[model samples]
Target: MASLCLTCVSEGTSLEEQVRRIKDIEAIESDSFVPQAFKSSRDDTKSAVVQVKQESEKGPSQDISLPMSIVYDDSGTLAHPSLFVDKETAEELWLNRLISLRQERLMGSPVT
Candidate 1:
């Protein structure tokens, strides 16, 4: 999943500090998250944000600047969050992994 998709977490050398507070989001939120943590891409963040926004399915993109929910989590109570990746990677994952990982859980089938 990491290789095939644009990961949710930054590719930092270590998330020790962040991991310590993952359970309590308030604690994490209290701290000013360094915005530069996410790795830069060729299209920069505009494309990535747009893709994430589209996958979130709030509405059609007017191409106007969407000022909200760029880092939204549509997973709700699911054990894991939704993914944002390129179309090629998504198709490859669906064909290969199918009902595994997050998809398996959503389908209510225990992973073997």
Candidate 2:
């Protein structure tokens, strides 16, 4: 499982709009994970917490945190939003995926 705290800052878009954009990403499947958006502690920023579960043969489940942030251009034109994740978290997830792939290959199972 992976948890991500995402903060979106945009002068052109509201917090809800940013949340919608985050949900619209093609890489994040509709059924994969649902994000919960709320006001940050600072009162001036918006944040979201996303939790993801990764299935593996090792044990029950592993929890990881992948914090992300998005800062839109200040031109109020809805600049391309970006999701930033820590390099270490990204690398760990990639390695886990690779290991899962190898296990699947060895088990003669089709990789989805």
User: How many residue pairs in model 1 have overlapping backbones?
Assistant: 0
- For model 1, the local distance difference test gives 0.52
Model 2: CA > 4 A from native: 1-82
Lowest summed-lDDT stretch of 10 residues in model 2?
1-10
Candidate 1, which segments miss by more than 4 Å at Cα? 1-82, 99-112
In model 2, pairs of residues that clash are 1-62
Q: Model 2, 1-112: lDDT tens per residue? A: 2222255453556766776676566437657767778765553344465677776797877676554555334555554433356788879888999999999999999998
* lDDT, candidate 1, 47-98, per-residue tens: 3333232333675654434443344445456554346567898898888786
Q: Would you list the C-alpha lDDT of every candidate in the order shown? A: 0.52, 0.65
Please give the lDDT score for candidate 2.
0.65
- What's the residue-level lDDT of 67 in candidate 2? 45
Best by TM-score: 2
